[model samples]
Target: MATILVDLDGTLLPLDAWNPVFAEICKAIAERAGAPPDEVWRRAREKNLILMRRLDWRAFDWQQLFDAVAEELGAGRAPSVLEVLDKHLPRFRPTDGALEALRELRAMGHRVEIATNGHASYQLPVIRRLGLDEIVDGVRTSDAYRCPKTCPQYFQDADLMVGDNPIFDVYFPKRFGLLAIFYGDWEREAAEHSRRLAISIDAVRPDHVVKNLKELPDAVRRVLALR
Candidate 1:
């Protein structure tokens, strides 16, 4: 049996309200700072690009970005990003077929783990709230390890990782010998990120790519075939 790692957010759970909730968070912080909402958002995005380039994916709750924006705006006190996320938590139900697919993978005797860049402070609540805690063998967070998936230790003894992020979940771990299942098509995203981040992302490809979670089990089967 192979050890497998699965991503959260767009992989295990659907992130339907991500944009609107984040926008509202920025607006609230901007209101407190007495700055234009666009200015606050721009600062957050700037900080996001910097963190992403450094492979720091631990702040999925956007606390780091929020703090940076508050500092730049001198907000003194910023609105709680987690509070906003909590209100919209219901919108983050499991992605269609995700639970079933995860069960299938585990039933095959694979050691399945929820490996995410998200901090446990926020991500775990959602996992448990939606009952995913009972489905997987364990959950792993970059915040817990103090490092992202780029670290070799994170993938130690793991045969594969399935996630939606082209860079963090796929490209970064592929070099470490983990087969990959990218949950979506990422050609345009890869090219755009290559230019936007000023990094060479050419020739990055996962062992399998599935646009639907229902296809995930078969994708895993194909990936395991390579082993």
Candidate 2:
């Protein structure tokens, strides 16, 4: 059976679910620093972007980012971002048809597993709460592996990698000889999503594209036929 590694955040769940958590982090920082929350959020987001671009994907740490934000704002050890995430996790809902897609893919005889990038402490609990454990064979996170899917070593011996993030989950994994499947339609996506999708499509060229998970099995079969 082909081992199909899947992404969790944008792939299985609404990526916007994280916005509130980050907002809460900024609020906490602002409260401690006696600064405007919007300005604090802007600065923190800028810091996050800088770190994201400079650090190796393996070295990216949320706690470190929070610490940096605190330093930048002179807030001195701001409240835990993990705590905010924990508080908001229950409100994080999976994308439409996501669970059914996993169950159907497994029924089609593929070995489905989660190979996501995020803090495992936060991500694992959300996965469990969403009932991902019932569908996927296993789960792995960047926190545990010390690398995102951008690192070829992130997953071993996978036939395919599927996700919405064009950079980390698709383009990067393609480097390791895994067939890449873009999980969302590019042209129909929002502008930001389309931009990333275009970049990945241009750079790495996915083997298949499925706008919805319901179409995933067919896409996989098509790729398998070529093999």
In order, candidate lDDTs are: 0.82, 0.76
Q: Report the CA-based lDDT of candidate 2 relative to the real structure.
A: 0.76
RMSD (Å) of each candidate, 1 decimal = 1.8, 2.9
What CA RMSD would candidate 1 show?
Answer: 1.8
| Residue-by-residue lDDT tens digits, candidate 2, 155-179 | 7878898888767666677777888
Candidate 1 contains a number of clashing pairs equal to 0
Task: Name the regions of candidate 1 deviating beyond 4 angstroms.
Answer: 57-61
Among the numbered candidates, top lDDT falls to 1
Give the count of colliding residue pairs in each prediction.
0, 0
Q: What is the Cα-based TM-score of model 1? A: 0.91
Worst 10 residues of 2 by lDDT: 191-200
